[model samples]
Target: MTSTQVPATPARVTAGPALTSAGLVTVLLGAALPLIDFFIVNIALPAIGSDLRTSSATLELVVAAYGIAYAVLLVVGGRLGDAFGRRKLFLIGLTAFTFTSLLCGIAPTALTLVLARAAQGAAAALMLPQVLSIIQAATTGERRSKALGLYGATAGLSMVLGQFLGGALVAADLWGTGWRPIFLVNVPVGIVGLVVARRLIPESRSRNPIGIDRPGTVFLAIALVSLLLPLAEGPVLDWPLWTIALLVVFPFAAAGFVHVERRMERRGGVPLLPPSVMRMPSVRQGLLVGVPFFIGFSAFMFVFAVTLQDGLHLGPFGSGLVTAPLSLAFFAMCLVSSRLVTRFGQRVVAAGLSVQLLGLLVLIGTVLLEWPNLGVLDFAPGMLLCGLGQGLAMTTVFRIVLSKVSPEIAGVGSGMLTTSQQAAMALGVATLGTLFASAGAGPLGMKGAFALVIGIQAVLTVGVITVARRLPDPRL
Candidate 1:
């Protein structure tokens, strides 16, 4: 099958409510694991460090290694799913993720846990792309919008809940286990997800299949690793000379990857990211906006965790509870997103950013007002606004970015968008996280450091709004 010979519409399977509902649940379950894993370890990090006697730098690697591997492989994962069957890849990846989660739970040492986390990330790369691809191939228009909205909601809620759940599990020491429950809990959930997915998730593949772009895949992976690894681990490791050199080499490698991809396109070969899609103005702008949005969002979460724990002297559970308002607001706004998008179009995104900015400012004001007296309750007003803003903007952006994509290229397109998001998220933790850490170490302390972080995030939010303005209204 070739691009020109591809059908105008995606080839349909016999989809009914039962199958669709089950599929959605399956994908949502798959989506939840990676995100949950991302933050679940955060609250547990202190526990793990104390238990294993690991340094802050090594512990950072425990997080960074997984993120870097996951971000690097995600595109190839999507392409592989296109070549094979999505259901097949989904099942395999889920099984791998579950097993790796177990490995993470039982690992005897810090080094082993880090390796297991990296494996878990690799498994996530295989599973995550299939969620969007399945939705793309299976649904259209309003139904598609709603599904995407749920995905956004799930993504946000999982980040918040992961912290809470991790905290609770660690505190509970279920089975006399401490932080291990964070990973161990996934065992039962994975079993249920796998069984349901096998029964309900229909196998779907690109009707117009293209051979794997092996060269493109390799170069892209190298380019991503070169860029992401340094950013994520550089500051934590005291900005080593090797990290600087890798960062310097990243752009050239990325350019070469693009050049090779273009050549492949001209020669009628498959490229991991098709040049044609990259040429679309909407796609280009949407990606531009997505990068900053994700970067700021991820960085904020990281900084918040550190601030609550290290700055305010809160325990894991307290920190998690503080974020409850944000999670609740996100859920509430997500429920109304489809209608809001319909009524407001791209402006809804702009409004969301504005609201988010307001929320941040309010939060900043509260921090300034209370200073040393500030606690989780003091954060409620700003958090509610921030949550609402994030929900509105992020979900709207998800819808806009994929608006022009068709089902044939859905896997690659979704891959392109998500890869940008994951890369930005990793960089966010690396760059902004470094800034916060450095500032906190200075005479300024944690409050000043948090204020600086939130200020930068606000600036990024402004950038997102500016880029979003250039996007076509009503999506397509």
Candidate 2:
């Protein structure tokens, strides 16, 4: 490892025992679970709905309930970690997550599964922010950056792996559990995480940990729920009056959240997010890149899974096989991207965007050309390129977003970034996925819908590149 001095900031000056490699691994393992669970359900949804006799709308809730709860609670979870302790919350969240997974696995009804999924998401919110907070508090400079890269890799890998693994588990029908095994598998993993985390992970909290910013926390939750809830469930419910009311309230809620947080910060009370942190050019521009990138990334994944299965008439495992290259390529590319970032600075994101756009174009062409004949072998090149590009963009943005954050509010900063990401994932699925569903029902059909979403994603990539060029160059 390259030698680098710890930051001389008082937070670092009084830092605890240097974080062990094992500790970092343990926390990162904690990070992987929520993300895995998030996408794992996608492939298993049909199985879940079939077995449970659920309506299409209820099945969609199985996904959205988790995402909405996870997104809303993330910032508060971070604040609690800062005020109490990261390790404590990590353990608490992990334990809750494990039990919730079991609850989901054994759920006998659609409502039961939805509730458990929401609970699992809440548990995840508690656990995830601590992963980033612990890294920011326990490590500095190059070590911190490397840890963040692994976190990013774990994240990107989890999305693809979740789909693949879920397919495998459902296909295997281990003990005839079908979709249940996808969730049950997390129990053992979470138990191991809890055990190792307790032994290896060092406890860390903010040096000047502040009390919960109640107003900011409340408003933040309201804003996110108002926005995410409608987007996630609106189309499924035929865009009801409540959903419309929430959508109308979303802007006012968000503005109120910002106003309250800023007011709290000016009073010298640490808000959920320090307004100053948001004002940083790096954080601002990095988030701009992240919003669309994640929206496109997630929308593409959701749409691809559906197209591979429903449109192409492939089984879960067959569809997963088609996408597995994306995961593998992403993992391989992410392992090396930190060095690329160290060399090329912000331009790496631009380059990654170029590659991602190429990959999207290829995917569009292949789908258009192959249509009914498209299969795993045919998807290899575009999938590989897409994953490589995603790995680069995701890892780079993870670092850039947190680069300027001071350690004192690392939990809050990390929380904000993650919340934005989770919210975007939820929103993308709601909007882009809705668009696909709508288009699929029209004369255009499923292949046409797939092409439409992919094309829009290509446009979104260009938007990210445009914003990326304005970002402050990396200092490394």
Candidate 3:
């Protein structure tokens, strides 16, 4: 409500120029890059470790730094896009992401790579929220619904493909670059996105914009780092005293963050994450639906990659090939998910979760029976079913979550959604990943650990199914 702030609702944003076919494709493509990069480093970890001579803790830092930085800055990025221009930030983010990727590609030390990865993540945070905000602002009615469906599908698929592509790229070694190619590949891709997006992607931003919430931003960063950092490093560092201290501090930090944001709103100022936005039934329920799924989804990918490499004795390309069924099935199901929602309503999500449960059971059976003999054929049936379910479940959930958010706050809402997702992924690595690591170290071995994690994921999915049933009617 400050005099300097733009009106809370602007006509230009509400009546945004129609996004062309090419424009939609360009933004969607841009959205996929950051997501893909998040997981693409998974399958390449072993090669990275060998080449960089880094310890397990250092490798985890490589992932954790990027994830933490990304999640922490996400809402702020969205706020900036709204205050400035979505198109301007998108180009800046892409350019910085490319440079950081290059820095990662040529890093001579593990420390340098981690630093560069953190910067790359910040750039991604800046770029991603605009994807949803633009779609929300530019498209309408059926067009908006379809675009959201496609965006959700793209988001979910990118995570899966990241690992597969990482494996393939590392295995290919493209002139003996080995694991470096995984990061280097983004350089060209980012450049292409820049060129296309500048021309095709329509510029859109919030009409009523507010200044940066510096206090809220700092507190949010503190809260996220406190929770995620310890979870990420505790097991690797043998649960040190400092990690314990950070864990003890998390609840307080999180509470303070909420208090600060609420205070800002009470003072008639927009906070980094508006309390009112969080108060929305759809936003809260949406997080409930998204958090567990992403946690399981992320942990599953990392553990699966480790199992394929260390337990099943698959090479990088072999592991990548093994996941081909999962990726293809997900992509296929996503293509039809919007239509399925029209026919089946939100029950598609419940049904999808049910399918996921069955798939997990199938996977348990396969693991118990096949053990070390597991291969593409052995894993394909369960992988296909799981992918199909996730494809439907994720796309529909995203639609429901953002369905109620008005264009006035589209940027913040989108940032919040993606932030929860990225944070959940990091938590997945911290929790289930740690559990798997421990189980493997114990007498049960890697195979037992993998089975245990999948069972846990099944239970998590079942819990999510109950929540999915409670999702407001998509027609709303």
RMSD of 2: 4.2
Candidate 3 lDDT over 1-476, as tens digits, reads 00000112222354568888789998887788877876678777667777899755566667767877887787777777877888888898889888999999999998999899889888877887677778777899999988876776675578567757887898888998888988998999989989998888777776676677888778877887788778767887899999999999899988998999899999988676677987788878877988899888878877887788768878787888777777778778878888888888778889998998898899989998888887878889898898888878877777777678886565566556666777777778778877887788889999899899999999999899998888876765
Cα-based lDDT for every prediction: 0.76, 0.78, 0.78
Higher-ranked by TM-score: 1 or 2: 2
* Candidate 3 ranges beyond 4 A from true positions: 1-24, 55-57, 134-150, 156-164, 199-202
Where does candidate 2 stray beyond 4 Å? 1-24, 53-60, 132-152, 156-160, 407-410
Residue-level lDDT for 406 in candidate 1: 72
- Please provide, for model 1 over 321-349, each residue's C-alpha lDDT reduced to its tens digit, 9 standing for 90 to 100: 78888878876787788788888788888
Backbone clashes in model 2, listed as residue pairs: none
Q: Which lDDT value does model 2 have at 220?
A: 76
Q: For model 3, state the Cα shift of residue 239 in Å.
A: 2.3
Output the lDDT of residue 420, model 1. Answer: 64
Question: Distance (Å) between predicted and true CA of 166, model 1?
Answer: 2.1
Q: Look at candidate 1 and give me any clashing residue pairs.
A: none
Off by over 4 Å in 1: 1-24, 55-59, 132-153, 236-238
